[model samples]
Target: MTEPMRISIVLVDDHPVVRDGLRGMLESAGDLAVVGEASDGPAAVELVARTDPDVVLMDLRMPGGSGVDAITELTRRRIRGHVLVLTTYDTDRDIMAALEAGATGYLLKDARREELFAGVRATARGESVLSPSVATRVVSRVRADTTELSDREGEVLRLVARGRSNREIARTLFVSEATVKTHLTHVYEKLGVGDRAAAVAVAYERRLLGD
Candidate 1:
């Protein structure tokens, strides 16, 4: 039987030792190959263009530019390589930004060698693999519990949760009733609810309205 083709990868991180360690770890898997290494975003983009690897192990906060920017640029340039974020950051902003910029997967640096290897292979296969912590953040953010809701919408939802009528909410917020209705419409749409009570319930459940 023919041997399976190796998955080529490019390592992008500012720290030389981290890169070396990762290269060693990945190469230990018989079907994996580290084809090139870059210490920053610009170099990473260039190296990726040259090597055309199956996957890119990207660090989020690097010099020259961030991994988010690199991923966006690569997407804009239409590079075929999938990017997998391997970094210490698991914040809502960092996770959302990397994913929004087209990263195929997000894994924390604390992942075991086997997990890292599996993540890279999954990423190369167009599968998304998020670390457990990262997955939680993503799920929470998707529930509309985050800053994704505009301030005005949030304020409207808060008043609604307090059992305030549209007119009462408008009076409390100092906005016109028409404006309050518009804001509530937006809130309901964002929260994926059909009415005021449902929107208020979702907001509270998602902790969008602080306890």
Candidate 2:
């Protein structure tokens, strides 16, 4: 019988020690291999493009660009591999942004070795995996908000999530700043959030905005 293919992985973390630790943990599994490594977002993108690994073990707050930025670029390029975020952050904003950027899974750095291993394998199989705490946060938010936003509200929130000011959003959408604020107010109400940051957080968690 032909040998089963080993799962190829690329590690992306700013710390060499962290990368070394993960490499040791992941490569212990006979079916998994660490094919490449990158210390920042730009290098991660370039490495992924060249190696085309089965999964990318990504870090969020790297120097060149964030993990979210890398994921967004990879999605734009239609890369075939999956991105699995492995980091210390599990805040609502962090989780939502990475997931919205097309990450296949999010696992905290503190996860048990077996869990991390399993999450990576699941991600490679096109499954969405979340750390337990992250799963809880997402489930709670998604269950509470069932009201879908109007197209304009979604557009407003998308710009907000991208860090655009109200005036900037108005200019981009060809609307007045007051109109932009009005749309944002409605978006906040619909998503049950009180402010711009919270609205973007919930919108991303609920997938109300296009990636």
Candidate 3:
């Protein structure tokens, strides 16, 4: 039988006890190895660079160095290891900050050992994993953003869905063609789409354009 590939890891948390517990828990799985550890963000960055582990388990609120900043710096330096945030705080601010800073995954400290192990393995493969609550918050935020189109933008999208050209839309809404183009641009941004066809599809998919 072929031996399983060992997934190397670096643990980055300020607390010695937390690191020790994590190391023991992860190493208990035959394919996971704790290759190095750091007590702060700066140290974590250095350790990550030195060890070149497959995954870096990061903590957000260390006294000396912030995990978000460490992830940002790692991104800036183009480090090879994927960062998986393992922190106590799952607030919108904390979760968004770490993800925006290039964390590959986010798992709360209360996660089960199996979940933690799975999160590490997923991160090693460059997959995005989020705790259930965190995922809910992120999805809600995205939905809220996409649903915030202005009344005028909504009118523009509805018309576009009906096969109206920009000129036709401006004429129907008593606006200039330039204004129609501008509204479409804003609609594209809000819907996170590239152009008119994509915007219309996303709008209907989200039920923004009702019958």
Each model's lDDT: 0.90, 0.90, 0.92
Error in Å for residue 118 of model 1: 0.8
lDDT of 1 by residue, 1-211 (tens): 9999999999999999999999999999999999999999989999999999999999999867789989999988988879999999999999999999999999999999889999999999989999999998899688655436888888888888888999999899898999999998888778768998888777777788897
CA displacement after TM-score superposition, residue 45 of candidate 2 (Å): 0.5
TM-score of each candidate structure, all chains considered together: 0.72, 0.70, 0.71
Query: Ten-residue segment with the worst summed lDDT in candidate 1?
Result: 140-149
Candidate 2 clashes between residue pairs 3 or more apart in a chain or in different chains: none
Point out where model 2 deviates above 4 Å: 147-211
Clashing pairs in 3: none
Top-lDDT candidate index: 3
Q: What is the Cα-based lDDT of residue 29 in candidate 1?
A: 95
Return the TM-score for candidate 2, rounded to 2 decimals.
Answer: 0.70
For model 3, how does the per-residue alpha-carbon lDDT over 92-185 read when each residue is reduced to its tens digit? 8899899999999999999999999899999999999999999998997677554678899999999999999988999999999999999998
Per-residue lDDT tens digits for candidate 2, residues 5-28, read: 999999999999999999999989
**Top-scoring candidate (TM-score):** 1
**Candidate 3 regions with alpha-carbon error over 4 angstroms:** 152-211
